[model samples]
Target: MSEAFEQYERKYCELSANLSKKCTSASLLDGEQKKQKLSEIKSGIDEAESMIRKMDLEARSLQPNVKAVLLAKLREYKSDLNNLKSGIKQITSNSLNAAARDELLESGMADTMTVSADQRSRLMASTEKLNKSSDRIRQGRKAMLETEELGVSLLQDLHQQRQSLLHADDTLHGVDDNLGRSRRIMTNMSRRMNRNKCMIGSIIVVLIVAISLILYFKLSK
Candidate 1:
């Protein structure tokens, strides 16, 4: 049991370190690269989590004393895993937000902050749901042991969700980039039209002044 605990601790530490490194390094990549790396990291984390869970179940099925110590260690590892995963999610989200901003910038779209109230509301609602889900997972860890199928299903669902978000984000950024280019072209065209209008106005004013002078001279003569 001691040997098993030691092995678990070592593996948990390795996974934690890997997760931390991935999270810290995420900010260094571009949007596409960020998305790719984050997906890979998430997959790795899921594998590590599954391993830890299996180890925990095996340890908990032992003698009472061994079970108690193993359970405590498992709890510690689970807590650390949760924290690391949360950090990874946050970093990934921040990367996506930054990518959105970059798309806005590249598109020459001014007032990126002018998001609709409805969009803002939806974002807030999503955030609340995420928080609630996190809390529920934390509370349900003990009971989650028996429901291994649930965990598997949950992972599949989450994988699908993440992939959907990635696709949506990429699509949105592409639209934003196109829109930005259009906005810049329109602005240039508008400036040119304004300049042409001014030139035409100046020409018309000069002709009127010349005609008035000629008429005045003829009348005076």
Candidate 2:
């Protein structure tokens, strides 16, 4: 658990212990003394509830592995707090009814006011939770949109690269065709040169033979 969460938990435990002692003490006292003790208990309960809220937020901020454990612990504490609150309410009702007949009207009015205050506190807590949830939803949506845009950009770049590769392939094929034509032309030229050389050799041989025969005839005459 985080340091902050531990601190809050420690503080809440102290407050709960103190409040329980005060509640037991209040049961034995009467009149003004009892009223004072109950008032202190109410204040203590409020402080403890605030500490629980802080602990819950800290637990949520923890690493996931520890966060689940802390959250579960917080839930147990909240349940205990609720049970404590119920006990307080029961104590208050008992004390209110134990009052003298003349004070009945005033005690009833006080109980109604206390109930209203509790309702308001619960409503405020609910509103805070709703706001936190809404913020988380908004953040998640924004992250998703950014991821989607990144995916689209990558796809577009891939398409462009594929087109470039296709163009290069076409260029290579054109180069290969030109090279093939050049090779065929060179082969034909070599063949024609060989044929011309053979014809030239035959003509030279014929000239030599005719010249030799003419010389012999002239000598004989």
Candidate 3:
């Protein structure tokens, strides 16, 4: 709450209370004095209404939560002001009837300081309802926050899972490459072994043919 707004709201409440007192007390005066007091109260009522409007604008400028609370209060104040406005009109008209005016003043003066039992009960009920509404709004906000946090956590988990899958895929590809290289090395070793066996067979056949020729030549001698 801005200091200026609080100050002005206090000013408005004071102005309203003073106007109410003046309206009730206006009956105590004579014809000329009563007329003057009613006129002054009328002017004060107008000032009070203007203050309500200014406070409404101030409430709009507040943060969302604060504004909600202030606007609710401003509405209550408006209702009270409207009641005062209506009462003033009735007072103005009734002032011409001396007897009726006297009766109203007697009752109004006492009622100013006192609330009837029913009225107090209703006021308490309204306050309780307002508190319940506030609690529900707070609970809704908390739920939304919790849901948002859960969504963020899920997204993080999903991202980590995707990264792990990609790493596993890379590992599989590396193993496949190593297997292909080992297969090629085995093929080359097999071919070299076949060539060595063929060369050894050719040398043995040549030795056998040379030894047969030496034995035939010795028999001829």
Error of 1 at 154 (Å): 39
- For each candidate in the order shown, give its overall lDDT on alpha carbons: 0.69, 0.70, 0.69
Ranking by lDDT: 2, 3, 1
lDDT of 1: 0.69
45-94 in candidate 3: lDDT tens per residue?
88998899888989899777557656766766776676667666655555
Highest TM-score among the candidates is held by which one? 2
Residue-by-residue lDDT tens digits, candidate 2, 1-221? 37888799779878866766676566555578878888998999899899998988898887675676566667666766665676567556656655642264466644656654654554454345434433443454455446546655766797899999999999999999999999999999999999999999999999999999999899999
Off by over 4 Å in 2: 1-110
Q: Assess every candidate by TM-score.
A: 0.47, 0.49, 0.44
RMSD of 2: 15.8
Candidate with maximal lDDT: 2
Higher-scoring candidate on lDDT, 1 or 2 = 2
Q: Could you tell me how far off, in angstroms, the CA of residue 207 lies in candidate 2 after the best superposition?
A: 1.6
How many angstroms is residue 45 displaced in model 3 relative to the true structure, after the best TM-score fit? 32
- Whose lDDT is higher: candidate 2's or candidate 3's? 2
